[model samples]
Target chain A: MSSSSQINKRRTKPAEVRIDELMSAAQTLFLEKGVEATTISEIIARAGVAKGTFYHYFESKQHIIEALKKQYIEFFIGVLDNAVRQCAADDWVSQFKVWIATNVQTYLETYPVHDIVFGVHHHERKNSEKNMMLEQLLQILVGGEQAGIWSLGQARLTALLIYCGVHGVADEAIANQLENTADFSEQIALQYLKMLGHGELNK
Target chain B: MSSSSQINKRRTKPAEVRIDELMSAAQTLFLEKGVEATTISEIIARAGVAKGTFYHYFESKQHIIEALKKQYIEFFIGVLDNAVRQCAADDWVSQFKVWIATNVQTYLETYPVHDIVFGVHHHERKNSEKNMMLEQLLQILVGGEQAGIWSLGQARLTALLIYCGVHGVADEAIANQLENTADFSEQIALQYLKMLGHGELNK
Candidate 1:
């Protein structure tokens, strides 16, 4: 690698800084006015970066999306893994409930902007990141089963079911489906936690 | 009203019949030609309906979607109610499993077109039908609680959990998110049944 390239990368104020600024600007503009409406020129203008810098960082909107999606998925996986890590020593079922609750909080907390990540956003927007996170959840469930904590015959399927309610509620929240959003999500998540923890819902 | 109008009303097929025909045509077109690529004219042509007749029966693609959604939710509710009725006298949990397995078959065999119902096509659609069915599920759950058949403290939330998993599996299946579709869903439902039936993952 060139010394100048390494030096610039380490500098973090000029070249590296501009990329972050551009990404933030693009995300803000894209969220405020959808992907179709936002343009590279506008994103560059917002970031106060020259057009060349934008090109240096991202070749096209598609390229920007690729970068953004990678980052977004990485962030999502981190959140889930963090949840998993928090309950590493607990009963698998209890830990599973905690994981589910985190997903709900992830949705409610993310709200309008971050909600897209919670849905069936299998678009180019989400791919490997989602699959990896899903696999991690499966691993948790499988661990539960192997330890005899969870007696599910199908770990993957169980993971899907266990995660399903959380996903649906989150999706509903994302879609603004409930008449009673606050109460409904709380009730839904609580119920799911109970059901997943115990076969019967008692929360 | 004229005699012709009276005759037409009597001779008119159930809105459901036309709706099914429309759905059949639409699904075929949607698969052969993507959802966005397919045109209203193509749908009408496939349905053998006139331009005005299409409007008479439905306002737009969204309207057709509305009708299809109502039917889908109703069908699911009908299945659940039937399951509850059959198992109301038996173990509520077992009955629920049988009902889910039955629906899983139905999902694979019959309504392979449930992607739209699962919130993927939300631009012109609303979540009202989905919630309405949820309310119905809650009613049955309330009955189970009253009779001490089910121990869900918050029935609505509990129902949300079960529904999210099973329904979400079907959603994934319809959304083509799973491999080995048939085995995947039923296995999960049964695992869920065991988990819900007995507190532990074990029987």
Candidate 2:
């Protein structure tokens, strides 16, 4: 093939790779400046993509922000899921501890990006992202209950309390710039386990 | 006295009353038409005060917003404090329970105003308002610990968990428009009490 044809072929990259490049570029600019300051032209320029390609994937800055939020939630949930899965299938308590630890650790490490994507919707009460995480916790709570490790008076309410409580405590940890999170996470897990009626573990 | 003098005398209201009138007018407008849409001129019009009076107390809309936030926090803290005070002095568990219940009840009743004042600053990491509320909770936790009502592995951390947890769950309650908050609050208090090592009460 001629050199011109080869150059054209390189420009026609896979759609997923193009979309990832655009999102990564937008995220970098959003961090450097802010969502309001960063524009589509800057994102396209940073990603080395054509203007048409950027428009093809995202209609506007707000559209891209929603896409980023969805992507961030998926990654956050995946990290928590993976951490819980490492424990023995029936080891519900261990599964929970790992979930809490991973959540705090991941959130602390990734909160800057998280703040970028989620800052606007932080006060949204009925958020789907929140429900998605709550569902994950509910599964664990129900599992532990099923195995006779613990019992719940109201599983969904209990899940909301735990989910929101852990998240709130993690926000405090971030504020305090807490060190020694392993011990911190352990203490949190212990307290929550006690709340779940697994006080026998305290012995 | 002349007609002009009579009108002047009417304008010379107490500073506290004038300020309260201004805040109330602004709050009414904020709820009716969001903060961004409400103007200082409209506020003065609603308060039946001159533009000079509005500017004398507040430099700009943003200044008034900050003032409103401080006022809101003070009122919120006062409400929680009053509810807790109604319990027996040494009844630490009842105090804590009342604190949680009142927090849910008051927040549900006044959250529209709360949202108007606090919406912008919701994500502030090290907010003084949050610290003030947290301090109130720490006092109860410390009191309970001293009385041997319960124990704490990490007093401040435990306080953060409970305070943030209760606040988060209350936000959920607001979202759900929960009607039976008395029972909801009791369940929350029981779970948190268990976390505080008062599991004996569960029997």
Candidate 3:
């Protein structure tokens, strides 16, 4: 490879690689000892990186975690957005199935955002920015509801259930409760949404 | 009345008074300094009780906090249960109004629980023995679906939506965004639920 090619690979790879590595460390520590018990020094140590290198990427400990959370919510919203687009091309049942596939794919991809994202507690008043997105989420959901393509009865409630099912996957994934014998997380989430949207068992 | 009679009156007050006082102290410090920074000493100091006195009523920090959480969740579930019970005597609209009333009452009364229960970084994941009663909630909702007493669409989704309205109240109340000036919180919740259940914009 040329010298420029070598530099390009090294530069692009480290940032993404370091982020994943740091996130894995945080996830491990956060699980073993809740978020309160884990610290920045421990995270850097586990990632085998200098403290300054960690700081180069993150503003604060909670900052990185919050970033992780924001990324997760954003990704799931993308999944939903994609589902909405897919549903536009088909009917409700088929739409729900595509949604399930998208949800599972997004979750199983291991983007290293799960630790502080979907399962994040919403009670802290400091998480104002994140909570703002939820309100906007309401706006988007309401728009979808009015569109007749979505078939929303209670937009807010439907959002919560759908979020809960997604959150359930994260919670289970974190605690490692997902049984290895079956890969039903995606199907279960689909069933949950189908139950909410129509409540009809398989025809 | 004599001093003795006044002392007797004080003595006869409910046990929850002391608990409420302790929880108030813990909640304030927990919000200010977080669960890790807030200590038993701080809680007792704020409550103006002896350290031993604190120990007399509670086992440890986690125990007391769990007690507070349990009481809060129970109080919430109790309100929902009572409302659902009362629903048997009324039309579906009135029943939904009653249910929403319970949601508003619980959210208003336990503002701290709303603070602690949501948005916090740390959540203790113990097996929830208390959630068993939720089956009762499911039964009541499913029964309504079977009776065609609901909107003739997805009853499961309807239940989820109504619950979301309840959950949304916490976030709304916490953010001080609930401007139920023309409508009371209960009334707003009821209207939201009615809209979800029947897709109605009317009384």
Candidate 4:
């Protein structure tokens, strides 16, 4: 074939790359115009993929959002896991602090997608994803309790409080548009640690 | 006029009573069938009021939800206020405890209505109603600080944490289908108090 004809041939990108392109395009559009406003055709157009290719991956626009939601949750939990792993296995204090701090930082950074996914789902009495995150947090609380760093009389309840409390305050921080979330995250960590009767309060 | 004729004369209820009837009926319907499923005609029919009465009180379904939301917030804050008032004026600790206890108690008691009114509102960047409730909690925190029950370095943030933490745990309690929320509420209050460096954790 001539050089020009060769250049015009369809380039076969990997399935993962194409899926990423579609998801990235969908995320951008969803964030820009909202989930309700964006459509599948727009996503396919934005992704520069054929309709068949789009269908090969996601069943619908909502399916893309579901995929994004799963990615977002995994991304968030992964961040916490990495933060916690930075400390020694026995140093549950650091693990707990890093968990809270990373949680605040990552959530503030990623809440737009968070809002897009979670905001649409109404008051779900039972959210498995939330429960999974709580399980991760409980590990930190229970680990600390076992190590004698603090007494967690009600470990699961305490985890729920800390997990929800962190998320709630992060929402507040986002609302106020605080410039430095790290300091606020640290403040939250210390306060929760104090609640756990592990860390000393600031004088 | 004959006695039967006089008794049959259309008994015009007071405006306050009429408005209460309309709101009560609307609340019940909204809870039973959800906001979208409940209709203005049903509300009027349930209230035994003419269509004009509902129109006079609320412009639309959304308008009724707004009214119900305001009433719900007031009812909630009122419960906390009454609980706090039961203690001595100078006893900020009791005031604070009552505030948390009443908050958890009232939230668990009334979350269905709360969800109905609030479930549809998107993740708001700023919620004035939430701010108002936070202000009420701040009073107790600052009051206790002035009384020297415990030092609150970051009183506003502390209040936010405590407020969010309490709500979060109550949600957990509800999710777990706990029969008695009092013990859980007390547990939450004591953990927060420990965070405040005032209450002792269970041994």
Residue pairs with backbone overlap in model 2: none
For candidate 4, lDDT tens digit of each residue in B1-203?
57764564557665667778998999999889988898899999999989998898789989888888998888888888888899998987778778888888788888899898889985885787878888998888888777777768688888888877888877777777777767777777777788887864222
- Pick by DockQ: 1 or 3, better one: 1
In angstroms, give how far residue B142 of model 2 lies from its true place: 2.0
The local distance difference test score of each candidate is 0.63, 0.87, 0.57, 0.83
- The residue-by-residue lDDT of candidate 2 on A23-138, one tens digit each, is 99999999999888998999999999999999999999888888888899999999999889899999999998998999999999998889888887656888898899989998
Stretches of candidate 1 off by over 4 Å are A1-4, A7-16, A83-98, A116-127, A138-152, A172-203, B1-4, B9-24, B75-91, B110-112, B116-126, B139-147, B171-186, B194-203
Flag the better candidate by TM-score, 1 or 2: 2
Best by TM-score: 2
Where does the lowest 10-residue lDDT sum fall in candidate 1 chain A? A117-126
All candidates: TM-score = 0.74, 0.92, 0.62, 0.87
DockQ of each: 0.32, 0.62, 0.20, 0.57
* Winner by DockQ between candidate 4 and candidate 3: 4
Clashing residue pair totals per candidate (backbone < 3 A)? 4, 0, 6, 0
What is model 3's interface RMSD?
Answer: 6.5
The DockQ ranking, best first, is: 2, 4, 1, 3
Clash pairs for candidate 4 = none
